[model samples]
Target: MVAIRIEFDDDEQYERLKKLKKHRGLTWKGLLLEGEKRVLEQTPE
Candidate 1:
């Protein structure tokens, strides 16, 4: 697996994502995996 650093243009967006993770009861790694899953699901096979 590759490590990546994603920067958000707005601090509110970053904070919102943090809140989402907390609300979903997911760790940082889990949040990343969930995001990856969503991306893959949206992509064409």
Candidate 2:
């Protein structure tokens, strides 16, 4: 698997994401892994 780094410039967006992570009780890595899993599930095989 390839790893990529992404940056977000909007402070509001960043804060919202932080809030989501806290609310969901997920670490950054866990949140990203969940996102990847969701994307893969939605894609056609």
| Candidate with maximal TM-score | 2
**How high is the CA lDDT of each candidate model?**
0.93, 0.89
Native-referenced Cα lDDT, model 1? 0.93
Stretch of 10 with least lDDT, candidate 1: 1-10
> Which residue pairs show backbone clashes in model 2?
none
Candidate 2 lDDT, tens digit per residue, 1-45?
A: 867786888999889988999999998888898899999999999
Over 1-45, each residue of candidate 1 has an lDDT whose tens digit, in order, gives 988788898999999999999999998789999999999999999
RMSD of 2: 2.8
- Top candidate on lDDT is 1
List the lowest-lDDT window of 10 residues for candidate 2.
1-10
